[model samples]
Target: MSSHEKLSAAANDRKARLAQLKSLKRKQAPTSDEADAAPSPPAHQAEISDAIVRTEEEGEAPSVATTYLSGRNYDPTTRNVKLGFDNLPIADPTNTLEYKAQQLALETKAQQEAENKEDNGLDLFKLQPKKPNWDLKRDLEQKMKSLDVQTENAIAKLVRERVEAQKVIRQKKPADGEGEEVGMEGSELVEAMHLKEQEEARDRRRDEEDEDGIYRAKVRIGTAFTLALHEAISDRGPCDILESVNIRSNPSVRSKTRWKSVARAWI
Candidate 1:
């Protein structure tokens, strides 16, 4: 394409890309609805407006048995009657005043009986302690005996220490054994035995240096540089070979050749 056409195509592509980005951003924005714009508090159940309990109507009216005669002039089938002074029944002279004497006598008897039975109950006394079993007593006795023994040992040690601290207290020298018993060995014999052992050890010094029985193999990192320098300068050869090694430098020499193994064990 020509330069002008390429530039125009590039500009068109850039504009198309910008338009697509703007459309994507618009799709990501939030809606304007009240429920969607901001968060709202959770809804709760409505409060109860009425009482839980209800009572029956108790107007100035009393109910009676329908089958019994009321003994006064009134309608037999009437349900509710308004209470008034004229409609109130005459109080019987016998029923109310007759029970007063018996009620007083009963009240006196009840008060006396209540006073006789008045007690705080058996909560004041402490309960008896439970008896210990045989095994528990035995274990307790054993522990006590052990404690006694430890205490006695401590006391005896303290007494002995105090006695030793007293300067006037003298220890008795032990009496010599029977007069004819043999005497102990002299120091010369110990010296002679020590010299013999030294001679034997000198004879086995080289074996002690080589053998694993008498010598401990050691590898220390701190002396690594010094050891390398020491080994390089010293005339010490490699480990003693279990087999042999041979090189093919002089091939024509019909000498018996051993394997040139690289398995050199280090000390």
Candidate 2:
């Protein structure tokens, strides 16, 4: 084979290996991002961990230093500090301790004076009493009672007027003649009259016939009367005699009476 062909084969092989590595890297990229974006710690745990880190970084020892003495070493155990005020020779021969004690005493006196000034500036006396005013509750109650009485009277008067007006209207409008007649006669009374007429007519025809037909007619009429009485009494209290009479007169219910009577007698 020629040198150019061998070099081409070698280049193809290298390219294939590079492509394989690239594919592998693509597959692992998502896992890398997932690892980097791990879930955050819980809030309470994070706070506690942060507190521990801060406490470790900042030593936990207390430093006994008073602001009154600058550039002075303070004993942590005794919580005492020596002032450097008199370290340099000056017009005063008093020791640093004595000067520090005088400064402390002056500061204490000033603080006490400030406290006294604050206390004296405050007014501790009770406030003066306000003038007595009218009782709103009692006033409102009296007004409500007055209004209730007035409203009740007005309502009563209005109702009375309306009732009188209705009475007048009723008096002026006469009842219909037909309705009045029907009301007076009643449905039951009319039905009873009709039934009685029918029975009388039947009896008259039966009398004209021989004995057997007359007895049958009498039996039929008796049966009809019994059925009507039963229907009226079936619902509640014994059928009102007046109501039964009216039902017998009623054109609608009256027609069924004959059939009901026959059924009753047969049974």
Model 2: weakest 10-residue lDDT segment is: 61-70
Lowest lDDT 10-mer window, candidate 1? 45-54
Write candidate 2's Cα lDDT for 137-256 as tens digits.
467678889898997798679667756765665577676554654464466457767987998799667545645665687899888767655764553343334334434345666466
**Runs with alpha carbons beyond 4 Å of true place in candidate 2:** 1-209, 239-244, 257-267
- What TM-score quantifies how close candidate 1 is to the native fold? 0.14
Error of model 2, residue 239, in angstroms? 7.2
Runs in model 1 with CA error above 4 Å? 1-130, 133-135, 168-267
Model 1, CA-based lDDT: 0.47
Q: For candidate 1, what is the total of clashing residue pairs?
A: 0
Q: Which pairs in model 1 have colliding backbones?
A: none
- By TM-score, who's the top model here? 2
Q: Per-residue lDDT tens digits of candidate 1, residues 147-170?
A: 989977986796567556432332
